[model samples]
Target: MAKTNLKTATAKQRIFRKAINLLNQIFFTWNNGNEEELVSFLQTIRDKSPNVQFQKLIASSVPFLNAFVQNQNSNLFSRIYRHPFIQGYSLPYEVGNTKLVHSDWLRSVLIRAVCYCSSVEDFNLERIYLELTCLTNGYSLRFVETHVQHFFNFFHLHPMRYSRDQIMYNKFRHNWFNYIKIQHELSDQLQQFDDKGQLIHLNYLYEYGAR
Candidate 1:
C-alpha cells in the first residue's frame, strides 16, 4: 500500500481558508448581539465594504435576527442557526380558537415569509422548520392556529400567481399576516409558553394536515 498525501495542505487551500477568515471578520461579526457594537461596525464598513448585497441581506434580515438573538441562548455563530431574521414571523393572535385561520390570505403570507427568511441565511433546515412551526408572538395558541390556516389559504389561492422567491406581502385589506419569516432557525430551540408563563406544546399548529 502506498502512502497517500490526500490530507496534505496546499497553497490554494490556505488561500481559501484565509479568505473565509477575512469574510467572516468583515461580514459575519455584525451578527454578534451587541447592538451598539454592530451599529458602530456597520458605520465603519459603510463606505469600503465587500458585496453590497450582503449589506442588503443583513439590513432586510436584521429585525428577525435581533429577535432571535435577544430570545435565544448562544454565541454569534451558534445563534445564526435560529437567527429569527431567517425564520420569518407571524401575526399576533389568540390561541385555541379556530376562527383566525379563516383568513386564508394571511396564512399564505406567513408561509411565504417563513420560506423567504429561511432562504436568506445558511442554517440547518430542520431547525428552521421546527421553529417556524412552534414560534409566535406570545399571543394565543388558538389564534396562532387560525393565523396558520389563514396563511395556508393565501398560499393556496395564489398558487402560481406568486414566485417561490417572493415574500407573501399583503395589501388592500387582505389577510392581515404582515410580518415575514426569518432566513434561519434559532439555536436555543423554541419553547412554547402560555400567558400564565406555563410551558405548553402545540406541534399541531403548523402541521398543514388534511385542510
Candidate 2:
C-alpha cells in the first residue's frame, strides 16, 4: 500500500483514531461479574447518539445479552462471524432485512459499538474484512464472536436459522429442507465438482444453503 493522505493530511482521521486509541488497552476489569462494563458502554452510546436504529439495537441487546458463542465460520481464534447472509434473512422474517452485507453504514455502527464494549482500539482487521468479503472466496482470518445472538434475538430469529453447523443431520438445516426433491429431469446428468468447487456451487443454492 502507498502512503496516503489519511496519515499526513487528514486532521479529522488523526483525531478520530486517537479517540478510539483506548481500544489498544486490554485492562478489562469487572466487578460482581454482572457485565456492568459492557452494559455501561452500551448505555453510553445509546444515550449519546441520536441515531434511532443504533439506539434500538442497543436497547434490545443490552438487557438480554447472552454469552458469546461461535457459529460455523468461526474458529477458536475468531469467535464471531458476520451477520447471516441477507439472502436468507427474509425466509423467516420481514423486518429490518436490508442488504447489509456490504453496507458501510451498518459495519461502521457495528465497529464502534463493539469497540466500545471491548474498550480497545486494537482489533482483528483481517476478520472484519473477511466479513465484508463474501465467504465463498474463503478467508484465513476470523473474529471472536460478539453478541450476535443479541442482534438475532432482537429481531426474534430462531438461533437455528443462523447457526448453520448446529444442525447435525436429521434435517436440522433451513426451514425449506422438506421441500427439496429431485425431479427425473436432472437425475441422469453426470456432473463433476471438486471439494472447493462444491462450496463455490452453494452460491447457486443461496435459498437453501447460504455459505
Candidate 3:
C-alpha cells in the first residue's frame, strides 16, 4: 500500500514537472528558442494564398488573439500584491492612480473584460485601449489613432501585402510583442506545424531546453 502511494505521488510530480517545463519553454523566447518563432508570426500574417481576404483573416483571429491577451492579463494580475498594505511598483492599481483615478481603472477594465476568461487571450490590451480611448497614457486622440490605424491602412492601401509606409517601425511597435505571444499561443492551438514552421510532433525535442 505504501509503495502504491509512493508511485502515485511520483506520477503526479512528473505531470506537474512537465507542465512547468512546457510553460517555461513557451514563455522563455529570449535564448531558449531561435528567431524563428518571432518571424513565424509575421509569416502567418503575410504568408497567404491569393484568395485570402486580409480583413476576414484579421477578423477571424481577433477573438482568439483577444482571449490570449486576457489570459496573460489574468496571470499578471494574479501575481500582484492586492493587499491594501502594499504600495509596490508591480501593483495594477498604480497604472490608474499614476494616471489619476478613484481606483485602478486599467485593472477594472481588465477585470471586467477578463475575470471570467478560462483560457489565454490577446497579447496587447494597451494597443486595443488606444483605439477605445482618447485620453491618458501620454496619448492624444491623433496619436492613439495612428497606432491602430496603420493595421487598417496596411490592408486598405495594399491588398496583396503590407507596405513599408503602412506599418512603419515606430508606428506598430506593440505588434512585435503581440506576435511573439501569438506565436506561443499558436503552438498550443495545433498538433501540426509550430509558429516557427517546425513540426511539433516530429520535433518533440525535450533535449534543447532545461528539463
The estimated TM-scores of all candidates read 0.21, 0.18, 0.21
lDDT score for candidate 1 against the true structure: 0.35
- Candidate 2, lDDT over the whole model: 0.29
What is candidate 3's TM-score against the reference? 0.21
Superior by TM-score: candidate 1 or candidate 2: 1
* Weakest ten-residue segment in model 3 by summed lDDT: 23-32
Whole-model lDDT, candidate 3?
0.33
As for TM-score, the candidate ahead, 2 or 3, is: 3
Candidate 2's residue-wise lDDT over 79-105, tens digit each?
223344434212122245223332333
Give lDDT per model, in order. Answer: 0.35, 0.29, 0.33
Models, CA RMSD each: 18.8, 20.2, 21.5
Q: Highest lDDT: give the candidate number.
A: 1
Model 2 residue runs over 4 Å out of place are 1-101, 109-122, 125-211
Error in Å for residue 46 of model 2: 22
Clashing pairs in 2: 23-120, 23-121, 24-121, 78-143, 79-143, 79-144, 79-145, 80-144, 80-145
Candidates sorted by lDDT, best first: 1, 3, 2
| Strongest candidate by TM-score | 1
Clash count for each candidate, listed in order shown: 35, 9, 9
